[model samples]
Target: MDLAEMIKILDRQLTTEGRTIHVDKAKEHMRIEQRTSGQGVSLSLSELLRRYHEDGEEALNQTILAIDRGLHAMASAPHLKGKESKIFPVIRSASFPDHTSDGRRLITSAHTAETKIFYALDLGDACRLIDDQFLDQEGLDEQSLIELASFNLSALPIKIKKDVVKNNTFYFIHTNDGFDASRILNRKLVSDMQAKAHGDLTVAIPHQDVLIFGDVVNPEGYDILAQMTMKFYTSGTIRITMLPFIIEKGKLEPIFIMANKRPMPGKSKR
Candidate 1:
């Protein structure tokens, strides 16, 4: 079927398959964020249908193709930016409340939400949280859904400005006012780093942020990474340093860093 017809068919099939739909016309962009049970699927479907109705199939197709190309490019070049560029994020994930059921946050209450978040996928990382199989069952083929699963965070890209190393840990800094680093990039970077070098390829997204990736093997290395990260904070190099987290079992498990004499260990988690 053509794009418009395909969109219409998909919409009807989505409801028949027992899915809910939501749309945010207030925002100029059409992003398919996280899907819990099934929120983002129809929300995105409706938005894409709306676009097809308004701009016609050709325009919608062009946008899809552009996003696909952008995602392919982002796999290698993380800092890619500027006009004609797209934040080709690859996966939809469930965002969690950072606290207990009472809504008290373990970190900050600012981000505790029962919403969906999207991330660019690195080919190396496995997608969890959402059931891709469900999409395929909803009359959408696997390949097309895979290509379109990513959110177009922005056409303006995020750039990495600088990086430094101390105690063999690499500290990467992305350009300010750009898209925040997603989970997909985090996985690829850490996996690639551990492969190239050694030690646990750890990470932390503090604020908008100062993206820190490193291999902290010993207490001294953690000390150095934490110290410099704090110094950067004092220097205004980054805004806030959220507690760093590690990747395990293809997921981000958050942890707090305590200084000197064997920092509190984040429980071994998946």
Candidate 2:
């Protein structure tokens, strides 16, 4: 019963049934398959502890492919994107925009299938043509992408200078739902031909992909919680994904999370 022992038997069957765990219905009961050798599929543990004892563990701990052997140990590591520029660990997908109650910011999907996973440092070949157009492998050119993902030919240091900020603040952890949850959780939505081809005309708000994990001397924010604990509670789902970067001067960046702070080494043995 992987997925961290079916979230410890669905957090002891939702603490003996008083009911409360609903991280988006445990991320909508988790699921993912994608395979053909690009390496995918894993996380069974008797069907995720019988669906987390029939549903709970925050409703089911959604995505990262529902953690089955931690998404086949991150799609089978050692792919090392051509072996260099280390600091791997990724997995992303995000979007924003969908507001109202007077602020009006359309473009909705009611939150596009969220997903997340940090840690980076692979500048060396800018992800080899998007991992050869979706992991068919082979692509790192520019001088073998600086002899394999740069930054001193990789031993993990693509560029993670500004240190330590555990759980720095990547949250979609919702439940209140009365609206104005910080402007509908930081909304977003552009696409009027991509916001007038980048001029960003106006009125298209609602953007919720937060992460405030502080550092440089406890700048604040901290809540590295990957929680799950359930067992029969019904109607559950939880999903929060935001992994895409490019915004130079307002912080809110991406990649770089393991200074060996620990807890990732085993990924619960696949």
Error at 63, model 1, angstroms? 32
What lDDT score belongs to each candidate, Candidate 1 first? 0.41, 0.28
Candidate 1 local lDDT, 55-142, one digit each (tens): 6767456445443333333223232123112323321112433332323222211221211333223222222122333233345443
Q: lDDT per residue, candidate 2, 33-57, as tens digits? A: 3343322222334545565566545
lDDT of 1 at 33: 19
Cα-based TM-score, every candidate: 0.39, 0.23
**Clashes per candidate (backbone, < 3 Å):** 4, 37
lDDT of 1: 0.41
Candidate 2, which segments miss by more than 4 Å at Cα?
1-92, 95-175, 178-236, 242-248, 259-270
Q: In candidate 1, how many Å is residue 267 off?
A: 9.7
Minimum summed lDDT over a 10-residue window in model 1 is located at: 106-115
